[model samples]
Target: MIVLLNLGFTITSTSQAADKIAIVDISSIFQQLPQRETVAKKLEDEFKKRATELQSMERDLKIKMQQLQLNGSNMEPDARISLEKSLIAQRDNLSTKAHAFEQDNRRRQTEERDKILNCIQEAVRIVATKKNYDIVINANAIAYANNAKDITNDVLKQVK
Candidate 1:
């Protein structure tokens, strides 16, 4: 009987020492971050010139295509062939530039997103350490948690 009582006490103490867990809504925090908007604006500004140039090229190509359709039948065979080759080359150039622009934009967005996520992670770590939390879990991974255990706001404050 005494041995069983001692075992029960040990179990109780172990349960009492359970780790302090906290939850954070990473997506919510990410959305609310000012850095996200700033990065978006920066990327927009960086790519705006390229986007405008692509639009201009597209417009020019459309105009040339229209002109060819209207006048190709009346033009000399060699001149028509030359104009067709030129349009094809222009289209290929525009396609290449547009593809490169898209790749660059995506790369920059990924880089900025990684930086922002790292910032959020650091903030979560700081909040968790300062608040004596033993574990910090992403809110999305869990089905349910009490509001009191949510440290998302604290993390956001730390980040900002």
Candidate 2:
């Protein structure tokens, strides 16, 4: 009984030293969350749709170029000039469209990243409050941590 009492005291002292400051892996939970997967799928579909549209435009441009090549020898000079002008315009339009898509995709990706980060931050705050932790550190900021000190699962559950 005396040994058991002493052991309990030692355990309490060790645990007290760990109090009020916790470490959480926000990236791990963000990667594992179902909402993140949903957001990723939506982004992926948007990217794919843009890629498909660009491919169709490219195919059309190639076809038009081939047609121009096959018929160029017999065409009047005005017709040839007009065709070349139109092809140049088409190429420029395609380039502009591609640039716009890239910019929009990047913007959307940034917004999504911010959204996930905000959610993680909110969860960390709530978990820290509920668990009586004075400060919650992000795992990325720490070099090494005890697994026993990981509060990621609790934060994940609270966030979800």
Candidate 3:
């Protein structure tokens, strides 16, 4: 009975060892993807116009402020009050627009990042499936793994 039990244990261990496992560095894969740069450039281009407009508004505000400081004493009281109110309104408008711009840019960046991540995941799945991997793990989640089991390059190739 002891001999049979030992034989069964050996079989179980052997079968467990036979499982095909692979590790992938997802961050490395993401950084190496050529599409990453393309996406960044696209985002930059998309936001460039808004950024330029904001800068122009800022310059105009600064000039107005300087003019007020330089000529406030010479201006009629009513005219000075009116200029002050206009500056305040312009400043508030610029602030609101700038805040919205930042939020929109962040949202777009996150959207783009998620899309790239999805692409990477699909590539990993394809490589794992084609190579008959029973388990695939992210390198970041583990303490250490043999370099031989790393299938990052294969996934990168698939993604590219």
Candidate 4:
């Protein structure tokens, strides 16, 4: 009975040892995937539009402030003070709005990039399962690995 028990344990260990180990280069997959460029271009175009709008608003604000300054200097004290305050307030408000828009745009891009990475993760998991990988690692995590062991192409195919 002891010999049979030892034999069974050896067989189980051998089977487990036979399982495949693979490595994936996630950065490579992201770089190679078409979705990466599509998402990046969309983000760029959105930011470009916002920047153009901000530039136009800035030009308008400068013009309005210059006109206010010229007219305020010749006006009554209260009127001049009010105009000065309004110009300052408008400048501050626009600055704040532009800053907020930039922050929100960056956050949106980060969230989208993360979502794409999640999809890539899922694709890797599915392909690894189909290929019977017992252990999968990022290529960057290993110092020395053959190019053959890098499953970047496989992951990209699955993701795309």
Q: Could you say which candidate leads in TM-score?
A: 1
TM-score of 1: 0.87
**Top lDDT model:** 3
Off by over 4 Å in 3: 1-18, 146-148
How does each model score on TM-score? 0.87, 0.74, 0.85, 0.69
Candidate 1 per-residue lDDT, tens place, 78-160, comes to: 99999999999999999999999999999999999999999999999999999898889999998876553889999999989
Alpha-carbon lDDT of model 2 = 0.88
Can you rank all candidates by TM-score, best first?
A: 1, 3, 2, 4
Residues 25-112, candidate 3: write the lDDT tens digits.
9999999989999999999999999999999999999999999999999999999999999999999999999999999999999999
Q: For candidate 2, write residues 57-160 as lDDT tens digits.
A: 99999999999999999999999999999999999999999999999999998899899889888988888888888767888898886743678998888778
Compared with the true structure, all predictions reach lDDT values of 0.92, 0.88, 0.93, 0.83
Residue 27 error, candidate 4, Å? 1.5
Model 4 lDDT tens row, 12-77: 986675456778899888788788889988888878877888888899889988887678678899
Candidate 2 residue runs with Cα over 4 Å from true position? 1-18, 44-52, 69-77, 146-148
Q: Which of the two candidates, 2 or 4, achieves a greater lDDT against the reference?
A: 2
Error of 2 at 86 (Å): 1.3
Q: Comparing 2 and 4 by TM-score, which wins?
A: 2
In candidate 4, stretches whose alpha carbon ends up further than 4 angstroms from where it belongs are: 1-19, 44-51, 65-80, 146-148
Which residue runs of candidate 1 sit more than 4 Å off their true CA positions?
Answer: 1-19, 146-148
Give the clashing residue pairs of candidate 1, or none.
none
Error of 3 at 117 (Å): 0.9
Model 3: ten consecutive residues of lowest lDDT: 13-22
